[model samples]
Target: MKKPSTDVLYQEESTYVDMLLRKSWSMRIAETVAFVLGMMILAQFFPSNDTTFKVLAFAIAIAVVGLAPFLYKATMRPVYKLTKTHLIVSISGKETSYPLSEVEQVYEGRHFYRLGGKKESLMVSRQFLSHLNERLFYYHKGNKRR
Candidate 1:
C-alpha cells in the first residue's frame, strides 16, 4: 500500500510566531527612541554631576524600554500547523501534535478548531484551516492504506 501524500497548512500566525521569536523592528526602534528620551528626562530631573550616575541612568532607561516589547512578543506568539497526517500546536515553546486518525471529531470551538475523542481535546487556531470544501474533497479522496 502506498502512503498518502502529505501537505502542511499554515496561516500568518505561524509567520507572526516566527517574527515574535525573532524581534519586532518597529518596536525596537520605538524602544530605542523612548529610552533616549527617558534618559534625557532623567538626567534633567536628577541633576547628576557624576558621569557614572548618568551612565547608569541611561543604561536603566534602555533596559526598561527594551524589555517591554521582548516580553510582549514572547507572551503573545501564536503557533499552529496542520498537515495531512497531523496537527501541530504550539505556544511559548510548548508544543504538541495529533494524528488525523486519532481525531474522532473536529469542529469550531470558540476561537479555534477543536479536535477530540479518546479522552483529550486538542485546540488549534482556525487560521490554519485550508479551504473547507477543498480540504474535505482531498481528505475524503485519499485512500486508506491497510
Candidate 2:
C-alpha cells in the first residue's frame, strides 16, 4: 500500500445547495418539474385563453433554458481543503490554492467563517467552522510570537 502524500486537515462533503449549483441534470430536472406544475396551474385558471397560456409556458421554458448556465455559475459552491500550509478551494471545476500566510482576516459568522485575503475571500462552511477557528487561532498566535 502507498501512503498518501498530502495530509488533509479538514474536508467537507458537497451540500444540497452545492449539488443544485454544480449538477446540470439536477437543475434541469428541477426546472422541468416546476415548469410543469406552473403550467398546470395556469391552465386550470385560464382555460379559455389557450393562446396566452401556451405563450407563457413557452416563454418560461425558454427563460429556464437560457438562465441555466448563469444560475449554475452564480451559485457555485467552493469545496474547501484546509491543509497545514495552504487552503485549497475547488469551484466550478477549478482548484485554487491560497497560502495561509496571505490570510488577512478571519471573520466568524453564525453560519460560516469568511476568510479574506488580498485577492479574494473564501467562505468556510459551517461543517468546517471549528477547524476554521482552530486554524485562525494558530495563525494569529504565530503572528503574535513574531
Candidate 3:
C-alpha cells in the first residue's frame, strides 16, 4: 500500500516497555553492582583453591555483561503514530507505515491495547496514550470484536 501523507491524529510518546529500554544505562549499572555482590557471596561458598569454580564464575559474569546491551535492545518498543488511515511506527530511528485497513483486530489487554495485523502487531500502553485514549478507543471501536 502507498504511504499516507496525513497528519497524526494520535501519538504515543513511549510505552512502559520503551521507558524501561531507555533506562538501559541505569539498569546496566545496577546489574553490574548486583553481579559484584552476588560474586562476593558465591566466593564464600567456593574455596579459593578451586580453579574450576573460579573459571566458571568468571565466564558466566563476562557473558552476562556482554549480553546486557543486546537484551536491552530486544526489549525496546517502537514509537507509534496513528493517523486516520495508517499507523506509523518508529523503531531504532527507522519508520514503517502500515495501513489501518490491514489491522485485523484491536483489543484492550490488562496493561495495553493490542493492534494486530496479518504480519505485524503493536502493543500500546495506556500510560503512553493517556491524552488520546478516548479518541483512539472510539476510532478502533468498530474494529474490535465483542
Q: Which candidate is the best by TM-score?
A: 2
Give one digit per residue, the lDDT tens place, for model 2 in 25-122.
45668788877887777778776457887788787777766665556556675577877656677877687666665554433453322334343333
* 2 against 3, candidate with superior TM-score: 2
Model 2 pairs whose backbones collide: none
Q: Which stretches of candidate 2 lie over 4 Å from their true place?
A: 1-5, 17-77, 110-124, 143-146
Clashes of each: 0, 0, 0
What is the RMSD of candidate 3?
8.9
For model 2, state the Cα shift of residue 98 in Å.
1.0
User: What are the lDDT figures for the candidates, one per model?
Assistant: 0.52, 0.60, 0.58
* Model 3 CA lDDT for position 20: 44
**lDDT (tens digit, per residue) of candidate 3 on 1-146:** 47675778677746445444334345558668867876777787888679866886787687666655446456554577877666677867688776654543433433233334343334455554443354455556765312
lDDT of 2 at 137: 70
Model 1 global lDDT (CA atoms, 0 to 1)? 0.52
List, residue by residue over 39-58, the lDDT tens digit for candidate 1: 78777767688877678886
Query: Model 1 TM-score?
Result: 0.36
